[model samples]
Target: MYLFTACCVLCGEKVKANISLCEPCLQDLPRISCCCYRCGLPLKNQLNDTLCGQCQQSLPPIDYLISSLHYAYPVGHLVSQLKFQHHLVHAKIFAQLLLTTLQTHSLYHSIPLPDIIIPVPLHKKRLRQRGFNQALEIARPISETLDIPISTGLIRRAKYTQAQSLLNAVERRKNLRHSFALIKPISAGHIVLIDDVVTTGTTVYELANLLKKQGVKTVGVWAVARATHHYK
Candidate 1:
């Protein structure tokens, strides 16, 4: 049961203590009922193909990917507020939703708990402008709940590129190329990348490729939501 009373972040309605939104609002959040296990893309027929066509052709560097919701409706609104409006509490809301998926999703049982959780790094300029990396904030609760260390310095965002959302699939890949540099050594064989939202999966793909070259045996992703419109 909820502890006390608080204002819902989404609706400004009264909610139980420690809850982000009212029950109705929470229930209205968009969800991904079926998706590609490799890239978190929503799929129409999981019974026919577990992996999407892109995944079947060339596997992403990610060993597994999990996104709990579609980047739609109030969920997208929440993410926008968190990213641009400096609403840090939205990070906690994202963490709580992702944590629930990690515990209950079918894929959860197939992969070992990550040795370290790496929130996708932001370029210095972006980090300075935003004042925070939303992914890192979202990852904090998960790290504490799962008892996994959050590795902040293992990778660095070396290039300041255009925002992924502003580009098409090809452009997104090109925008992120060599953007991340491994600045620190990591002994953890199994690691997971955390992000606020995953669209084309280019960012995580680049990261996972880098990790693989560095002898990281397994790379996975945990994202709050997935944008399925563009994948190339």
Candidate 2:
């Protein structure tokens, strides 16, 4: 018999099977301590109130947002490697981290669990080019851990739009208009939308609008990372 060993992707330290992170790397992962509860944008001050200035001025479409990490430092590097390089090991690490955060974070623990998880869909052309939907890959482990079924066929990207990271907030919103459509009827009361990262939140907002129209009362977002500011 052969024994297999796994090492932490970040530190190269030995780890148990089925996990990519050692204790140190897991503890060192960039976490979002304070953020807007509505959109998950990192905040400067730690206050009792969860909404940021922008969220207070204009409420987000989604009922709530829960993100595990900030899009900075090593977390951003890991995401880039996973998304562009197809390093699926990073996806597993992300999913595991997200699950741990959801289970332990007081804010997330208080919120009601979603009935089903729906990963943000990729356009067919982009999906083919990438060979996999990063969101879907990230969602699988979360689904298994939470015992919630993931629904991928309910919604689809009807139009291929430019990547959100490449556009400003205004352009991102404009680009995503009418980009997604509901393919089949959804019966879930509360649905959680999963994505790798939330930059401008335009993509999730557009998709949430479609899900809300289908009578999903509570639409929440679960992402690996949340961008504090808009990307250039």
Per TM-score, the best of the predicted structures is 1
Q: Cα miss at 126, model 2 (Å)?
A: 0.9
Local distance difference test scores for all models? 0.87, 0.85
Runs in model 2 deviating more than 4 A are 1-5, 16-18, 47-49, 230-232
Model 1: number of clashes? Answer: 0
Score residue 120 of candidate 1 by CA lDDT: 97
Clashes of each: 0, 0
TM-score, every prediction: 0.94, 0.92
How many pairs in model 2 have backbone atoms within 3 A of each other, for residues 3 or more apart or on separate chains, i.e. clashes?
Answer: 0
**Residue-wise C-alpha lDDT for candidate 1, range 1-232, written one tens digit per residue:** 1122378887789987475788888888888888888778888757412888778898888988898889898888888988999888888888889998888888888668989999999999999999999999999999998999999988999999998878988999889999999897878899999999988889999999999999999999999999866565
Query: Pairs clashing in candidate 1?
Result: none
TM-score of 2: 0.92
lDDT of 1 at 38: 79
